[model samples]
Target: MNGTLTLDGFCHRLAADPLRYRKLHPVAMAGEFVDHFGVPPFPRMEGIAGLLDRSGIGTVVLSHETGGLRGYHVGTRDGGYLIHVDASEGRVGQEHTALHEAYEVMRERLHDLHPRIGLAAGISLCRQADRFAAATLMQPYWFAIFAEASGLDVVALQASYGRSYASLTIRLAEVMRHQPLLAVLYERGPQAERPPGMPGQVSEGLRATVVARTPGFRLRMQRRPLSALRGLLPRRGAPPPPGSVAERVALTGRPAAVDRVSGYDLWRADDLAVLARPVIWGGQVAKVSVVAVPYRDRSVLLPQFANAAFERTFHAHQVL
Candidate 1:
């Protein structure tokens, strides 16, 4: 649980204390499963490693016979389950399917034990299995330790982890959820229409999604055109739109600032700054991560405050 995480070390710990994880959360269970058996995240996994040992998985049948289905969990007459993973799918896809099917098989058992659980819960359980799959690959416990030592150097971490930019940033947001900050993702895509005649048309722009935040920090007016951000500012003095800088950063896909945000005024900062970086995916700027950067000097210039690696990483694949 300290320093660099390793598959062998994690397995040793889990084996040493099996009862400790007997009643684990879904996310934790996924992490432990991958940690215990070294399930494929990036590098290729040997023929169905983790799923083979699971009791719930009666048999892992690799087939394209499920009528184009990548993976399917089928229950037998003897009340056993068979997980069919795609024979044509890559290692990563297979890993996800296997984990998802495994969770689904277990969910079926839980429902049988409590008939009142309801069919509506099946959809929710499936969605939870998706979460479990994500957690299995990018375990938060390991990610937290890695991020801390690396100064939350996201660019390096993303490359190392071999995950999508959004996945890495969103996980970073989750890791910092209890701290004094607001982590948001702004993606450039087709804009959704506003309430009729509500605003000037700015078709095709960045749309913001709140990834995670500390309990104290809140931004109700988070949107494509952050015009309502004016209300979030202190009313004592006539203030400019706080959203301009962030909007520009999202639009331009760079680190920028309007002015130095006063300490403890916005984002609950003693020494912090708004740092935005382009979330590059497949050689294009698809999204941006706008988050608070912990810094000593409040007067540092816009892009200079941004990490060199972070800045350079996106600039290679500039704004779309």
Candidate 2:
């Protein structure tokens, strides 16, 4: 377990034998750790601290000068771990950092793998540990239940999970794997700089949009030729209609009615309609997630009418 392994190599090894690493998945592994200490679902600050304490993390300190570090773990004199959190990062950030550090500490104990002390290996290790932290904080099964009951509203998800937008979005993608749905994350950019083939650009305020779609949904999108009907990959310049859901949502941060957008949106199918929700962080629209159910029955992924609407909308707005 002690050697130089690139992050890519480590991931490839896990992918090669999924069964062996099955227990290594962040959610599954974190659940095991939580269960060991009888931690309940949606464990908050105290519960997380308890998990850290029981995982050989001896002390948790909040520091004013993290030196640009969000969190870090050091070996204690008695061979335990000390986790330091940057208090300036706020509560959510501190929680995420603590959990991530605790996970790495526990991982080293459970697997008997020596901690990578080298800077390069340490950086890779931290990245992998961060993924685990996200899964642990979000708790996939619990989040999936919430998503099913409440739908995929990014703001609501953040509130319920008590996690940062970035954490929830990353973990949400993992939970969406078993479901017949797609979850995407978009980074907002300026309206005028939208590249050709991007679908969700708006006027004046919102610019670059980054959409992260589920694997299955992305594949389905690839089979379609319509630029607007595909995933957020930039295409030859084509703007959605002025009053379309993409346009309205991009501009106003308000979701267009599902029925109104049923046949016209890329995320919607004949039977399964996608829901678009924006994640606003730091007083700006940082990301938008589009969740859609995958194909279940034999029907056109993109109907001719939807295609016609795209053409009409494109033509109508071309003069602008």
**Highest-TM-score candidate:** 2
Candidate 2 deviation (Cα RMSD): 8.8
Tens digit of per-residue lDDT, candidate 1, span 132-186: 6657667766777676654454555666776555556657765555445545556
Candidate 1 local lDDT, residue 229: 45
lDDT of 2 by residue, 84-184 (tens): 88878867777778888876765565444433321223777677677777776777667887765555555567767777665566676677675544444
Tell me each candidate's TM-score. Answer: 0.62, 0.66
Q: What clash pairs does model 2 have? A: 184-212, 185-212, 186-210, 187-210, 189-207, 189-208, 190-207, 190-208, 196-235, 197-235
TM-score of 1: 0.62
Q: Best candidate per lDDT, number?
A: 2
